[model samples]
Every structure is written in structure tokens, then in C-alpha cells.
Target: MVSFTELNQQNDTITELSNVLCHLIDERSVCDLKVTCDLFFSYVDQVKEHLDLEERELYQSMLLHSDQNIRNTANKFLSGSGEIKRVFGQYLKRWSKNKELRINDHDQFVKDTREMFQLVFNRIEDEVEHLYPTVRAVQAAMPK
Candidate 1:
């Protein structure tokens, strides 16, 4: 079971990585594009790992909670995971195809990179503000 502190640290790492990748995207260099794609994929992998942990350790337990409110919240968050994964998968496909991005793709790449950063930032904020607190509450209420 991952501790809450550790999870927050992971979030910080991901956010920092995303920022760096976004800056790289703005550089518009083929070499930077390659680095950006690499970092983006790394970000995706980290997100997947984080989500997997949440699903297993946090959401699953919340879903099984005796409290209906807890179950509902967990379900709501879990519901969004699929769409998030889908979007990330699409981005992965697009980036993976152009390990070395073409000049024509530069505009599209910048747009996609910004959009991805926003998506991740929003999700992380939601989790930090809402989901993490809920999870901590549930865990605290659990009989130790």
C-alpha cells in the first residue's frame, strides 16, 4: 500500500516532468521533439502506475465501503479513468508514430502537448483537492 505522502510526491514528480516536456515542445526542434515524446511516454507510464495503485489500493476499497457516499465518489472517479486512459492512449499513438517529428507536424504537436498538460494538471488538482481527502477520510475511519 502506497502512503499518501508518497502518492503526492509521485504527483509532484509527474507535474514537474510534464512542465519540462511542455517547455521542450515549445522549442520546436526535432531533437527536442524526440525528447518531448520520450518524456511524454514516461509521463504516461507514471500516470498508469499511479492510477493502477489508486484503483487497487484506494478506489477498490472505497467502492466496497459500507458508506454509500464513499462508494459513489469512488465510482465517479473510477468512471473518468477510462476516458483519461483513452485520451492518453491516443496521444501515445500520435507521438509514437513520429519519434522524430516532421516540420509539418510541429503545430499539431504543440497543440496536443498543451492540451495534454492541461488534462494532466486538472486531473492532478482534482485528485489532490477531492479524491485524496476522501480516500484519507475513508482510511482513517477504517478499523486499524
Candidate 2:
């Protein structure tokens, strides 16, 4: 039973974290520069929390409100989550195998990760800007 204000705050926090993580992909050392190690972990944690909440609340709400065609499109976006999970597993495997990746290899890692991040980020932005607005309208229409 989260309030709308709380949900909005969570959305804002998630967007801010995603933007920071995008920048960090270009410069991992930036995490060290401006944030405490604990804060870096917090950012990671928040991103995960945001994703979970989006799947549970926002996406569900959107699906409940959308027509079939739009719901199918949202399904396509979700299929990309499998790709994200595969890439994440690959990253873990690579890390485990090497113990530490070379600095040069980090470029390739960033390239792959950036592609995956963009897919998720774009879907999130689309849902936030378009689909969620429809959901809000649906909420407004309902008896309260």
C-alpha cells in the first residue's frame, strides 16, 4: 500500500541511479571519486530494488490498463530481460575465470554491458513516459 508520492520518489531515485550507472560504465573509477564505497553499493542495491518494484507495481498496473497490442509490445521488452540475465551470468563467469580482467578487456565488457543497459533503460523510459501515464489515467477514472 505505497502512496503515490512514495512511488514517485522511488521512480526518481531509480532514474537518478540509472543515469549515474550509465556514466559509471564509461568510468568505473568515478564511483570511487565522488561516493563512499557504501554509497556505491547502495546505488547498486537501489537499482535492483527499482527493477523489482517496476516489475511488480508499474508493469503490472500498465498491463492491467493496456489494450492487447500494447501488452504484447510490453512482452517483447520483457524478453530482453532474458538477454540481460544471460549477459550478467557471462560477466560473472568471466570474472570467476580470470580472477581479474585486464584493463583493456574492460572496454569490451563495457560495450556489451552498455548495449544491455540501453535495452532496459529505453524500455523503462518508454513505460514511464507513455504506458504509466495511461495507467495514471485509469487510476483517475476509477472510483476512489
Candidate 3:
């Protein structure tokens, strides 16, 4: 069972990692630093795991909901997740290959990374603002 509390915490963790990674990039030449690299990969894994869990568990309630609006909401978020995954995958391939960071251009890496982080932040906000409320409603209407 993926509790809302746990899901929210996962969001918080990803948000924190994003913030930290963004700041870490600011220190210049931090990209090849082992600690920074590890943190970056950790952030990537955290996001993938969080999205997988949401699709596998959280969204099911919304999808099976009796209300058409709730089902529509689920579909919207599901589509958004697919887009995020696709974009995020491209980001990974662009920056890291064979689990290694290949920074041919540091400035471009920073720019793209910040954009990627914002993409994730936007998705998190949408989940919190739209999806979670719908899920709560679905759960509330269920007979415990």
C-alpha cells in the first residue's frame, strides 16, 4: 500500500535532491566530482521510482473510479507521466552514457539540467495539485 504520506515524502525527497543538484552544478567543475555524480544519479533514480510507483499504485484508484471526471483526470496524468518519462530518458542519454557523465559542454549541461529539474518540479506540482486530490476523493467515497 502506497500511503499518501509516503508519496508526498518521495516528492519532497526529489525536490530536495533537485535543489541540491542544481546548487551543486553552480560550483563549477562539480560534474566530474564523484559525490556530485552520485547525487545526480540518485536523483534520477528517485524520480523514476516515484513515477513508477504512482502509475503502479496511486493512479489505479483514480482510473477505477466511478466518476468520469476522476477517470479523465487519471488519463491526463498518465499521459503526462509517459511524456515525462520520454523526455527524461532523452535527457539521460544526452548527458550520461554507459552510466557516466559525458560533459562536452559544461554550460549546456547546466542549462539542460536546470530545465530538466524544472520539468520534474512541474510534474510534482501537478500531481500534488490535481491527481492527489482526485485520489483522495476516490478513496473517501469508498466504503472502508
Provide the lowest-lDDT 10-residue window in model 2: 95-104
Task: Between candidates 1 and 3, name the one with more favorable lDDT.
Answer: 3
TM-scores of all models?
A: 0.88, 0.57, 0.95
- The digit string of per-residue lDDT tens for model 1 on 1-144 reads 779898898899889988887777676664344565577667877888887778888887898999999899899888777778889878767765544333458778789878987887888899999999999998889889
Q: Give the Å error, residue 91, model 1.
A: 1.6
Whichever of 1 and 2 has more TM-score, that candidate is 1
lDDT for model 3, please.
0.90
The TM-score ranking, best first, is 3, 1, 2
Off by over 4 Å in 1: 30-34, 98-104
Give per-residue lDDT, candidate 2, residue 18: 57
Candidate 2: residue 93 Cα off by (Å) = 4.7
Candidates, ranked, lDDT: 3, 1, 2
Residue 107 in candidate 1, Cα distance off native in Å: 1.2
**Which model scores highest in TM-score?**
3
lDDT of 2 by residue, 1-144 (tens): 344576567667656765666677577555344353344345445555655565566556445544775566445545544555566556546532333333346577577656655655675576567655655665676678
For candidate 3, the TM-score is 0.95
**How many backbone clashes can be found in candidate 2?**
0
